[model samples]
Target: MIDAGSSGSRVHVYRFNYCKEEPQLEEEVLFHMIKPGLSSYKDDPVAAAHSLDDLMTRAVKMVPEELQYCTPIAVKATAGLRLLGKDLSDKILNQVRSHLTENYPFPISANDGIQIMEGSDEGVYAWITVNYLLGKLKPSQRGNSAAIFDLGGASTQIVFEPVFSTPSEKMSDGDHHYRLDYGKGDPYSLYQHSYLGFGLNEARKHIKERMVDQWMDDAIKTGRVYHPCLPANHNETISYTSKATTTTNSQPEPIDIQLIGTGAGATQCRAVIEKLFGKDRPCPTSPCAFDGVYQPPLTDTFKLRDLYVFSYFFDLTQPLGMPLEFSVAEFGALTSHVCDGTADDLLKHVPGAWTSLQSAPDTCLDLTYAYSLLKTGYDMAPERLVKTAQKIGGVETGWCLGASIAMLDGNQLCKA
Candidate 1:
């Protein structure tokens, strides 16, 4: 299974034990990732398919030569492609389909094998992945299932079984409710929503735009701009195209803006990040999450229930010596430290911690944005405990596992 996500593309090769009463995933035999997702090749789609050459070669070697004929290879794109118009997305998918059909040893079932996945389906698969691994998928164990908070590059998703008493009909028309069977004992209903433009990278872009718009006049006068969310020592020259003043060319001209950070820490950064949540927007529904999105009230059950937050959430925390089980307040304190500390100070505290200096500049902004997204956007309690990790029980913690399971069940490849 190939997950063509916004930030990158990853392939998961699963080995299943079909001898069991119900098929079980014995292990994820091979997993590989390539950067700059298929969306990056919107203009040249053939290159998009070519980008997966290395990953496909690895996949071919993982599956036995004999079984390769029957094995299905599928690619499902997420938010990045969805944001691109349908025509462009289809071209990319078509190119991928062509590449797989001509070059790969694995079976290419049909064009549907490579397509864009809906945002709601992405949320559902992630929810299933977390619950299935935790042994919470059974009907009797539904109440024990943990909520999933996936923070991706282009979008964020929240999926859970709401314990609120509101009738399904009472939910706003926009709410997504799914009845998933997964070849299990019984089906269960899950409430899931994906918020576009709320992902870490998208939020950063929004912050940059807001800062530029707010400080443009002053920046033009003084040739310097201040962003509180950035690290104290952060300095960058960003170019933005300005509206044409005259009609002759009517083409926007690019202008370079200098951004310098004031030593303001998390307190100020939080203020900037919080605005992206659109908390002030009025909702037509009685209970709304944010930006008028419908959501069941977070009752006592929700407050007490466990949550598994992955993707960027795990990426940001794991390097900072955070435990697997930590409270939102503790996470906030950690972000505060990152916000206040300089890049050199951070390295001194945790020697050889950062994997890349390129990402070091955004640590403060990303951490602060994540904190606000949890506390202000999701209304999660500061003291509530949540699990954040890249993997659980030897399997990766993401939608691919659940998606592979769903594909096997749908194709009747997995036994009951």
Candidate 2:
């Protein structure tokens, strides 16, 4: 099967040497990753082709023993495809197809496997992961209302599913959380959706604009020339959060999610939140930690997702690309936030924990500037800033997970 992902294309030969008639496993083994591949295309089809050729060689080399002749290559493309124009996309697809069919003895087509899923695909994946993790926290009915936000490299997502009994009929992934990404891989089960446009960097930029916009409104309302938010009046940097599009889904029941997070950069976001909005209580009350998929009373009918599950990850398609290694384990750590020992806390637990500012110097300045502005202008309570950061961090992660969930929601997984 082909996995066209944000980074590149991955080919998987599922049933290598299995006998079609006997249905017996042979010496042939399954393929997971075909590396050195065309994972990202910045719209250069020629460049992409070069990467694909290198990756194909890598795949051919990875075949173990006698399986090389038996296994059929299921080629797929993912994130990098979106960058190409229609002409280029078609050209690339045709090129890949021809190359595979001409070269591989047991050649596979890209469209033969799962591709082109919907928003719900990812939503289902998010729901499944949420349920799995929540199961660790509590034993309850699987189907219940849960909201999600997912920040991804290519896009962002927000999803809301009301209370319902887990279907006796299950999806193909078998877990529940659906995968949303199309043109390549299968959907995962977990929580909800991944909003595409509003990830961390973009969201942060949006937040900065929003803060200025709000500052103008506040100044107009209060009628003060030296508006608290204005640099002319004050040099304080106010904190801001990435706001989201409101959900319209009715709340059938609270999912009471256990807060499962996936993807890298989540912990970094949590740190940013703590910096801007930690509680000022001298006497320690709650230990320094990130909040779970928290629920706040905002509207009457539907509410936001229970927790944040992802981070504002930069798109891998960019020239510089996403920072740090994005891994499931790293993401798993973010979602596993609790009052007890966690790496985020462990990293910054002691007196020097908060002092670890070596990662991003510019970010430190931004944080400081934002914090000063908010504190001086809005008279924002110290605790409120901490709370806001926690919420923002959660929301950012939640949106990403939500997007991933949507990608996996409506798969023909039962067939799997």
Candidate 3:
């Protein structure tokens, strides 16, 4: 199974036990990832499909050569492809299908093999994966399951079995409720939603656009514009086309602007990023999550249930030597320490913490946004315990495993 995510694409080669009544994940034979997701090659669909060649080669080697012809392979793209619009997404998927059929040894099972997954489905898959690993997927364990919070580049998702009763009217909305039937004793009803423009990268883009608008206005009056979220020594050229401003012909024109950071620590950084959460957006639902999105109150359901946060959340936490499970206060303290230092200071203090210089500039901003998302967006208290990790019990904590499981389960459920 291949997961074409926003930031990257990953392939999971699995060996399952079909002898049992229900297929089990016997072994994850191989796993690999490549940067710049298939969606990055939106303009060139063929190249996007070809990007999987190296990963497919590794997959071929991992599976038994004799069994390769019978093995099923699939590619499911997430928010990245969804953001590309239907025409481009279909073109990319078609290219992937052609490449796999013509070049790969695996069986292309059906017409629906390669497709774009809905945001809610993505969340449900991750939830299934974590619960399956945690021994919570059995029919007897229906009520006991962990809530999943996945933070990606282009989107974020939340999925869990709400403890409180959902109104019949609300449950009728397909986006709010999803039924998962694994051809088992009983099906599971999940509350899930995928919020676009809320992921780490998209949030950064929104925040940067706001900064550019203010900076450009200030630069006209003053000679300089300062960015509080970046390091004091950080200097970079940023280009953006403002929605508030357009050319005389009403077409948006890109403008390149210079940014000089003024070392404004966590407090200021949090203030700037907090604006992107859209807290003041009108809420038709009495209890909304953010930007008037209907979400079951997390106060009662999330607090009582086990919560697992992964993806970018784990990436940011792991580099700081933080525990896999920690409270919001501990997370805040760590972000505070990170905010107090410049890029040089961070490098000097936490040697090898950062993998790239490009990521270093936004360390403070990223950490601050994470903290705010928990506190302001989700209303998580400082002492609420949230588990964050890249893997659980030697298996990657992502949607790929769950996708494989769904595929083996005959793809009857989770059609969305």
Cα lDDT, all candidates: 0.80, 0.35, 0.81
> How many clashing residue pairs, candidate 3?
0
lDDT of 2 at 197: 30
Superposition-based RMSD of candidate 3 using all C-alpha atoms, in angstroms: 3.7
lDDT, model 1: 0.80
Q: Looking at candidate 3, what is the lDDT of residue 24? A: 73
TM-score of every model versus the real structure: 0.91, 0.40, 0.91
- Give the per-residue Cα lDDT of candidate 2 at 88: 60
Q: Worst lDDT window (10 residues) for model 2?
A: 254-263
Candidate 3 residue-wise lDDT, 202-259, digit = tens: 8987776677766677754443457888888788776777664588999987766677
* Of candidates 3 and 1, the better by lDDT: 3
TM-score of 3: 0.91
How much does candidate 2 score in TM-score? 0.40
lDDT of 1 at 85: 87
Residue-level lDDT tens digits of model 1 in 1-416: 99999889999999887675556778999889999999999999999989999899999899888778777878999999988989999999999988899888787644357889888888898888888788877657756788999999999999987665544443344557676665556666677889988988888878766777777777666666888977666788777554622246787666777888775988988888788888789877657777677777665437667788999999888777778889989989888877776444555556456544346787888888998888889888788898997887888889988887777643534232
Candidate 3: give the clashing pairs. Answer: none
